[model samples]
Target: MDRIDTSVAHPARRYNYWLGGKDNFAADRASADAIAAAWPSAPVAARENRRFLGRAVRFLAAEAGVRQFLDIGTGLPTAGNTHEVAQAIAPSARVVYVDNDPMVMVHARALLTSAPEGATAYLEADLRDPGHILAHPDLRATLDLTRPVGLMLVAVLHFVHGEGAALPIVRQLLDALPPGSYLVASNATKDFLPPQIAAVYDRMLTAGQTDIWPRTRSEFGALFDGLDLVEPGVVAAHEWRPDEPDPSLTPADVSVYAAAGRVP
Candidate 1:
């Protein structure tokens, strides 16, 4: 508890609040409200991103036959986690969850639950340091690098602000995996926002009032270079093989971009 800072608003806590979860503080709520003030459908986008995650996991476990998952930036425990989604299809599935948040480390017990035939492990690590995350003993113990693995970087990369920062980290992680592995990634984008709203977002971003770093479609697509993108190359969060139509939302509402690609 000493390491946890309640005065600051962290991305995971704010996301949990957006998802209508209770593991957040006043600061998180404030941050969420600030974002929502700019984009009124912020909560809808969060839920849509979660749904995209579930669909991507299902595609990997069921269609792609991936039995191992390395889910980075695994936020607060939700209904359909990587192991749960994969293990449902393959009981022998294994998962290694990595996150830098101390609160996530504290709630890792909820993430460690595994099917009797499967396994799950959690480690406190940052996405920016893929080397540490990949070389961590806990990660090595849970996942077999020799086999095809599903690398999940869902709804987390927007924090890596700058023109050419995130791609290098992504490339490094993908390089460590075998040829048959798959990469599932998504990031918040402002391409769908109207020019006026985008200007407001830009002002907030420049003033350091918001932490999310919105990227263009080309920037998001660059992360998948040297890999084979699955169907629907890159689309809005709710548009990627959606289980059902979300009539209440539109492309602008869910400004997050999502895609799944295979490492060749």
Candidate 2:
């Protein structure tokens, strides 16, 4: 494990803070608070993003019949994690979590637990390096590449700081999976945010605490170019198969776009 840096705020730690978790440093809390103060819906959007993860995993495990999952950019182990949700539906499910953060690696044990009949593993790898992630021994040991896999990109890709950097990575990972595989994603976007909220988020990037590149709806939709999108396609995170109605959460309040696509 690498040394944990408490001096700067990491994206995972700041996200944990926003989700009301205790495993974060002072710098993380400060950055999270600053974002929340500027965008009052930050915490709500975080929770909604988590909820989207749960719903998508459930659909994949139950309906899509995907037993193997590659959950990239998995942050701190929280409620309704990928393995927990999938294995709960199919006890024999296998899940591999990938993240480069050293702090996340330290907490990998929590995400490693699986049902007795199932398997789970964690890989400390960056998403940008798709080749490294695909070649990891733990990934190879846990999931069968020949079989269909649910490749989960969740709330991670927006961290890539270039215009065309994210989509190629998405394609690279998807290209590795079989035809029946699925891509589950939830990405942050500035399409529905106030101009001031965007400015404040930009300031955080300038501070070098953490960085994100929120995309437009069309840019996000382009990620699933060849795959067949699931019903209620490419909408706000909260609007994708909601379990119940929440009048409090409007489209603008859910600043993240979510979708699930199947490889034909």
Identify the candidate with maximal lDDT: 1
Error of 1 at 6 (Å): 0.6
lDDT of 1 by residue, 1-264 (tens): 689999999999999999989999999999999988986767888899899999999999999999999999999887898888899899999999988888987887654699999999998999999999999998899899999999999989998999778999999999899988999999988898999899998998999888888888999999998899999989998999988877877889999999999998
Clashing pairs in 1: none
Q: What tens digits encode model 2's per-residue C-alpha lDDT throughout 66-140?
A: 999999999998888999999899999999999888889779775468999999988889999999999989899
User: Against the hidden reference, what TM-scores do the models get?
Assistant: 0.98, 0.95
Write out the backbone clash pairs for model 2: none
State how far residue 187 of model 2 sits from its true place (Å): 1.1
Which run of 10 residues does model 1 get worst, by summed lDDT? 104-113
